[model samples]
Target: MPNIVEPKLISGNANLPLAKAVARRMSMHRGMSVGLVDARVERFNDAEIFVEVYENVRGEDMFIIQPTSRPANDNLMELLIIADALRRSSAARITAVIPYFGYARQDRRTKARTPISAKLVANLIHEAGIERVLTMDLHAAQIQGFFDIPVDNLYAAPIYALDILHHFKDVSDVMVVSPDVGGVTRARELATRINAPLAIVDKRRERAGEVAEMTVIGDVTGKRCIIVDDICDTAGTLCKAAEVLMSKGATEVHAYTTHGVLSGPAVERVSNSVLKSLVITDSIEPTAEIKACPNIRIVPTAPMFAQAILNIWNGTSVSSLFERETLGPIYEGMYSAA
Candidate 1:
């Protein structure tokens, strides 16, 4: 057999902490020698992005961990620049481990002249020489097809289920809630995994990021409700849904989201809302305001990202990470040890 190419992990300024954590986990797993690539991604005085890889990457497999979160344009540019740099260095293959895919909300055009920015972004990644993409909880599932290359979309349902079971010792009175009808499928999967009933919040959006009115569809009376969604930007929908759930007699309201794009007044809204707690992953790095918010809690996704990187590097089954029982223990062990 030919010698296996050791994977090289690199990251942009977007969520560097998550990238470092993933590198640490990979290094600790089975005595693997994986580490972050010696790369310097910086911005020029005029705000132009520059990337310089210090170490040799020729014939090596590369995983770039970058989330196009806040300052989406800058972060996205950094990713593209880094990928171009790595490709020029002749890396064997480059996989973008985008924990939170930005521009994803614009996957489709709802109006006459609006652009499908997600497809444009996907094409840009392809042109930048990314061989594959690994993202979690995309806003729209069909965005995967926009890429001609292979795309692996991971779910955070397993992580949420484990956290929920640990938090609510007895889940007998728990209910999974989807803030909008579009998210019923995602919420239902989590509900099924945890053996709980599913609820949907019927809301009409007068415009993007604005919810007109919300009504609870299912009976949440006296139940601990957990709202599940992919992104939590501005948080108007989540907050409104929680308020409606509480009015409908839900005992408590909690939120579990994959990408906490807590932009603008999101932190303030979540802090002042009826939500008992907001659990999010480290897909987007939390700001100081988010950290100081008492009700906000974050679960690390580094272990899962590390495992996925290793699996893809070794040509293993990336989908198996979705198994609840298996995912929980693995996440706990790696996270606890780290």
Candidate 2:
């Protein structure tokens, strides 16, 4: 029989705590010792990135856990360089476990002269010799097609549904609201899981950073509203949506998102907004500002990611790990895409 190569986990500087958590979960689930590979990633005096893998990965299945978050350019380059180094070391296979895939919002061109940066990023990863990719809740589902390699796009509805159910005992009083038209499908999935009604926020974007107006479509009067989306960047859309929901007689408005990019003035906006609270997964490492914001709560995605990675390594079906019956149509769509 051929030698059985155990899976190895490697992490970039993007989010070390999340990587450690995933490693611990994997070790616990497998009933064996699983540790991260020693890979030093740093920047030179001139700001040039350098990567050095201290251990041999020859004939090993390497999984690199790196989220392309803030300082996106630097973090992105770091991931690419690390993958290139692993390829040179003859690792049996390289899978990039990107919990938060940056540049995903740029999957298409809104203007004539603009570039589809997401596709370019996908090409770069393929050029770096990555064999597969595992990501969660892409800004645009179609972004998966940009990659030639197999892409697994995980959904956060299952996790969020559980949390919402636990927090709100009376599900009938709670309603799921999509902050914009584009997010209706995502909100619908969560609504179906929690058995709650659905609402949509009709908003027109005048420009990139500004939302011209917002109108609530469904009845939110006296209802506790839960707004759902994939990413929370500047918090502009979420904050505005919450305010509109409240003005429309929503008793409370809470927001949940998969990835919290939390860019400029996001924390400040969220804190002052009418939202009761904002819950996000730890896909991107939270900054000091995010941590200090009392209204922001972070849920862990490590356990889910850990299970998915293990299934991939063991050549098992990952969709089995989630509740297909509860997920319904979303599960069917994701499976077809995979």
Top candidate on lDDT is: 1
Q: How high is the CA lDDT of each candidate model?
A: 0.91, 0.89
Candidate 1 local lDDT, 98-193, one digit each (tens): 999999989997889999999999999999999999999999999999999999999999888888877787899999999889999999999998
Candidate 2, TM-score vs. the true structure?
Answer: 0.94
Candidate 2: stretches off by over 4 Å: 324-338
Worst 10 residues of 1 by lDDT: 329-338
- Model 1 residue runs over 4 Å out of place are 1-4, 333-338
Cand. 2 Cα-lDDT: 0.89
lDDT tens digits by residue: candidate 2, 1-338: 23547889999999999999999988887899799999799999999999999998888899999999988998899899999999999888999999999999899988899999999999999999999999999999899999999999888888787677666767888999998889999999999988999999999988887999999999999999999999999999899889889999999999999999989889999999998899999999998889889999988888788888988999987776467453433223323322
Model 1, residue pairs in steric clash? none
RMSD of 1: 2.1
